[model samples]
Target: MDAVVIGAGPNGLVAANALADAGWDVLVLEAQDTIGGAVRSAEVIAPGYVTDLFSAFYPLAAASPVIRDLHLEEHGLVWRHAPSVVGHAFPDGRAAVLHRTVEDTAAGLDADHPGDGDAWVELHRQWTAVRGPLLDALFTPFPPVRAMLSVLRTQRAAGLLDLTRLGLTPVRRLGSENFGGDGGPALLAGNAMHSDLPPDGAGSGFFGWLLCMLGQDVGFPVPEGGAGVLADSLRRRAEARGAQFRTSSPVTSVTVRGGRAVGVEIAGGGSVRARRAVVADVVAPALYGDLLPRDSLPAGLLRDLDRFEWDGGTIKVNWALDAPVPWRAPGLAGAGTVHLGVDNDGLLEAAKDIALGRVPEHPFLLFGQMTTADPSRSPAGTESAWAYTHVPSGLEWQPDALARHVDRMRTSVEEVAPGFADHLVGEHVQSPALLEEWDANLVGGAINGGTSGLHQQLVLRPTPGLGRPETPIEGLFLASASAHPGGGVHGACGWNAARAALATQRTGRRLRRALVGTAWERVLRDPRSPR
Candidate 1:
């Protein structure tokens, strides 16, 4: 094979497709019997009622240049935009609905809180100025220095400084500072909760702005049929370019020779030799400790790995409903995605409870009604609803315990959308342990790979040297969510890794030659090393 990708996740597929597009033969190996790692969609509850097993909404997907450049829309990937982008349901039967148009959303805010409309408009205007260049810097593989220079040029000095402060501040602080009214801050904080990080945690403010602005620019969309359609489209595009996918084939190890990755060993003792490079879309810790030999890893890299923390796990519940959820707040009925909580304070309390290893009685839940967003997701008049809540890291994920929590989450939703529990014709609950069993990359159910905290983002992701995807082992790279521009369904990480590999193949020299030499020396000294 010209290149062997170890996982058939979106990132892995994207990486393989890039190599194939560049005229290199590519092979993808997946542990599961299917493709699309966390992007899978299935009829888990009832017939003709498809539910997204993991990611449903695709704000990032719509904005990703990788997906747009691939033109997956040509391959049956039609997107359906919701009229009401999102809704936050408060305890007093009042809901804040974010509309597709900024002016409309601002008008709605102004109704509740005077002067909030002007604040929202100003914020939107500021974000619009830098959105394009900011996204380019994030999704491109150009060195950080060069990328920063580009950002500086595109967004003037004052704009660049504002961007820096926006990226560094916590979501809670950003919300408090920008949005003077309670409704405005609550809206910002709700979007930030999509990541496992708390609103007060550093680096979360970027997500708040990104998600909110994405919602304003392009409403969160769901692929017609299900989220799987998006993945299927990518697979078709890859196959068209001579990329091959082998499902149910788990890679045991990435075989290295002479300090260079040459092949991969599958779980059943089969091996495929890579003529040029081996790209892994597995999580960082798993790739380092399980796939590669410890002696073949640099000491500093290993130390950084030890300090890396996986984000909190999640429990997902899917329901086949007989009817749409009856919302207590009439305005929330039109929303595709609804958030259930009393207020921002209530959300903070719930987040704190999850951080302390105890499930909150009223958890901060993200509820998605696929049938409302895309009518094809369910049969006529029927609804398909799904919700997920974050849990403390490494908590015991017993099935029975999870079932009780699922019931609690359902009841919590009922508080906002009355009669929600009664509409369920069928239900499926997936605990954190179940998620890990489905995809090992979701280690401990940290779906976004690792924590999205300030200390672990950008060049510091996975670890400093490994952020750009190049590893100590020549021709091996990290193309998973663990890399820079972390998480989301965007293929930036995979694209960057593929570009780097192509560059190295042309140069005939690895990027981290010194690190490779050190690892090779340690491997040679280990008497117990396998020949």
Candidate 2:
């Protein structure tokens, strides 16, 4: 095969599709009994209810150029949206909602706080001005020279200095500076909580702002049937182009000969050869620590890996409800996703607790109303819902501990949606360990591949190396979210990796590989080096 893509996650499948579209022979190997690593869905929550195992909503996916270019809709993929994009439910019978349009969102905020509507409008206006180039810069590979140049050219469009200042400011400060009340600030802080970043963390303002604006632009859309359908569409499209997939085939290691990835060793003593490239959609630590031979890896790379930080562990609870969530705040019923059971200050407190290795008394929950987003998620009159919260790392998730955490989660929900528990037909709890079991890349249930904090993002991601997917080894690329641009449903990570692999073929292969090896050494030895 021209390429052997390891781990059939969305990134891996995207890499396979891109390579196949390039007319290269491609094969994808999934360790699990099924495809769609974190994007899978099943009826495990209850009979007739389709619960997304991991990620569900996809505003990022809708905005992603890589995913858009494939036109998955041609392969039977359908996008569905709830009436509202996201809602932040307060303890009181009030909610701050982000609607599909800026006007509606602003109106909601304005009703909550007089001047806050204009503040939101100003923010969205700034976002609209820089949206194209900013998204280009984000989805492009590290250094993003072309896209950055485009952004610079459009600086006057949105005031580059002001934009930069907002991007660097902490979300907590940004929200307060712009809004007169907590309603608008709560939306920003809640969105920032999607990452491991705290409300006060530098560079969190951009993430919060970005997601909020995207919600207004595209809405937090989901597949019409289930998230798995989106994955299946990608697979179908790739298969149409002749990309093959093998499930239940776990790759033990990447076979490297002469410091080049040549093939992969599958379990049960089977192996597959990749005549050109090996794109691994696995986690960075697994790729460096377990897959490759230790001797072949740069000592500096291994040293840096030791300092690799994952996001906090997550506890996800899925429920098959007999009816729609009896949300006291009626505004929340229309939202596909809800940031519930906390306010701005509460989110900050929870972040502090997670940082201090203590679970929050009232965790900020990222709740999804699946049936609200897609009616097919469950039978009529019922709702398929899930909520997840971050906890400190290193919890054993023993039965007693899991039960307690689960109850804490339920209580958190009940605080907002009064009769939440009464409607539960059944529930499924996925501890950190269980999440890892289903998707190995979700190390300790830390989603977004790794920490999305500024310290660990951009060029510093995975390790202090070039944000590009190319590793020190030739013909090998890191296509997982651990690469630059951390997490989300967007396929940029995989697209970047596949494009990098293809570039090797067009360029002088030997010379380029040798140069890359030299650059890798310098980067590994001195992360600050610009060799």
Output the TM-score of candidate 2.
Answer: 0.98
lDDT of 1 at 9: 83
Residues forming the 10-long window of minimal summed lDDT in candidate 2: 522-531
lDDT of 1 by residue, 138-193 (tens): 78763566656666777877877888888878788987887666777777888999
At residue 485, candidate 2 shows an lDDT of 83
CA shift of 385, model 2, Å: 0.6
Best candidate, lDDT: 2
- What TM-score goes with each of the models? 0.95, 0.98
Q: Give candidate 2 regions above 4 Å deviation.
A: 526-531
Best by TM-score: 2
